[model samples]
Target chain A: MSTRTPGTDDGSAPLLTLLPSTPGGAAAPAPERADAARNRRRILDAAARIVAEKGPDAVTMNQVAHASGIGVGTVYRRFGDVSQLLWALLDDRERQFQEAYMSGPPPLGPGAPADERLDAFLDALVDRVAEQRALLLAAHSAAPRARYHSGAYQVMHTHVAMLVSRLRPDADPALLAHLLLAPFSPDLMHHLSVEQALPAERVKAGVRELLALRDRPRPA
Target chain B: MSTRTPGTDDGSAPLLTLLPSTPGGAAAPAPERADAARNRRRILDAAARIVAEKGPDAVTMNQVAHASGIGVGTVYRRFGDVSQLLWALLDDRERQFQEAYMSGPPPLGPGAPADERLDAFLDALVDRVAEQRALLLAAHSAAPRARYHSGAYQVMHTHVAMLVSRLRPDADPALLAHLLLAPFSPDLMHHLSVEQALPAERVKAGVRELLALRDRPRPA
Candidate 1:
């Protein structure tokens, strides 16, 4: 009735893949059905399209269902709730970003110098914050209301910490991680961009210079 | 009848000493009667006592009035509202700290080397954040709700910015101001101490090491 994977779930990757669904629904279904997978994909695609058209606040179950050409119940079945849907969206984004940088191309993913990679990371991060500020705010606000704990931010911080540790073994990774994330801090970014009337590119440039300082050794 | 003096009201230090009496009423006083000055001193002393005991949040107008044995109207007369009272308290503390550093002694004051002053500034700032976390948070929270514009934080930032610019003239003062303030950023500090469980002293050590890197020029 039930079978277990040897070491898959125990690892720290957080199991982005669908688990094998077991009999009596003990595991997940041992594996997702082909049609189930298709429906899940369609729901997510529709949700993203709606969010893109309006904003995260405007994307609703009914809208998603309409866009996916499915019943609202199916959307609910895939995501369980609105908060879960938002988490799924953010998690999907986080995973895609990680994969791209970790294995993608010369500048950001791999094969570039550590300094260049660091600069690219800041630039990409600022751009992402500018484009996704509303969605990011929604995800964080929804965090307090989530049924289950959201480990999405923790995963992203850990990934950044590891990269910083690898790039500069002697530096304090925790501080580095905080500094790396500072540019994307919601209140600060909003205050600087909207309140202070600073251009996004100038803000990114300042962040890039700040990170560049970390690459050098301390002067006497 | 209205009265004026060479050093009164317009643009001199005595402007602070001259307290405006009941606006619409006939002029009741000149040079602020001795009793009013004594009461003002008593109020400031009591305000500090209340803040030290109950924190900035709990130092209510009625409480300060009661503690100083002054009328509630007098408290309101002295400071327009609760936020003004709290800001005055913090401003008093910051003023003392600035005086000590600008001309008081070595290390934190003018006698130390520029690099050592920078190092000491980071250490003192981290320790200040640790000691006055509650006041800092209250002041920051109250800033958004304040009715009157007081350029208090701007003054503090400018002081620190000047110190940083002197230390690193080649660096952007505004960005350096942000970087220097990073360790003291309330969200970052709270996250590091409460969520991350880092010992306060260790975080200060990390900051010291981090700021030490500011002096070195990045390789071309």
Candidate 2:
């Protein structure tokens, strides 16, 4: 993990900062020392692992502290509570995802063709949502429409719209991108992956097929 | 409006029946008399108008009764309460929509080619969701994931999947249909139509553009 400042690392800084806003309207804290950043990373990783194994509802501060081998007081001090901690985890994952698709590497990041990058980004999105399904679902349930309003969704929409504009200059990339990303909503993902018991690979392939739908000629 | 039996009017019987299940498991009521059916229609029509003019939150039994020009007792007797009444309105509209798409005409119905039918169906779906945006959003908020499990969604999904299968025999039509339908989710529709204030026609066009995405040649 790069130990850079949380929201300022990339062009997505504005939206990323909206993810884990400080409670009580406190002024932004001073920059984290290297050790504090490392601790934050460890706490978050441990929390994510717990969420992966148990589910978001099962995450308690005590369990997170125990799992991270950090003091519970420090965990509480850093995160304030489980809800805030979970948001932080979500923000953390989203930042990493933003970094990957924004500038980290080719295909998902910068160098690949627009179509290839679009495919890569969507495929990676499927994995990202699946990896954090429970947490995402929990957050989604709290406010369903808020998903579209969130900074994360805006960033994803922006990225997808950029690629879509390149692929189909004649099309409305902004609206098309929203429609394209609609399938990856956490509730739908849960229904497909958990309720219908579909494999993630199958979901990714279906998304690709939807993308490649125009590749086939319309019947006469 | 056809005064046909609520769930038995078409092949969507099973799913349609799931919509307006009685609050208490008091065995299914007997078929309505002609006058009773007419009154039910009036009540539902009145409620739908209120929902359209104001919003679902503004619907009240007394208001519906007054709008339908029927006694409040009759409205209560037929529809039970505001919640059940809203659902019946949804069911009533869905039945009409289902009838239109299933066997009513050429394009959204059966006579047109599968691709045209697919386009027509999605276009109609945009209208359908927009018309019932408030009620559908409330239903979705009540249980976000229950959408996939709902009879209405299932029927729509089945229809879309069939069209997709006819359009692309090699594709996984079921999965594609689900993904294709995702953009029409009530929350997203609410965001687009209400929040973003994009006209329904624009949304419909964007949907069509998404459908036509494959028409363009891929960049070399």
Per-residue lDDT tens digits for candidate 2, residues A184-207, read 999999999988899999999898
Off by over 4 Å in 1: A1-34, A76-84, A101-117, A138-150, A166-171, A196-201, A211-220, B1-84, B94-121, B138-150, B157-172, B194-201, B211-220
Q: For residues B1-220, write the lDDT of model 2, one tens digit per residue.
A: 2113221222122212234342222343479899998898899889889788877766677777778999988987886667677777877788789889999897999999998888789889999898888878877877788788777888889999999898778889999999999999999999888888999889988887776665434457
Q: What does the lDDT read for residue B67 in candidate 1?
A: 86
Reported per model, the fraction of native interface contacts reproduced equals: 0.07, 0.70
Largest TM-score belongs to which candidate? Answer: 2
Question: Model 2, which residues run further than 4 Å from truth?
Answer: A1-30, A214-220, B1-29, B214-220
Name the docking class for model 2: acceptable
True contacts kept of 2: 0.70
TM-score of chain A of each: 0.70, 0.84
Clashing pairs in 2: A214-B214
Best-fitting candidate, scored by lDDT: 2
In Å, residue A79's CA in model 2 sits off its true spot by 0.3
TM-score of chain B of each: 0.65, 0.83
lDDT of 2 at B168: 79
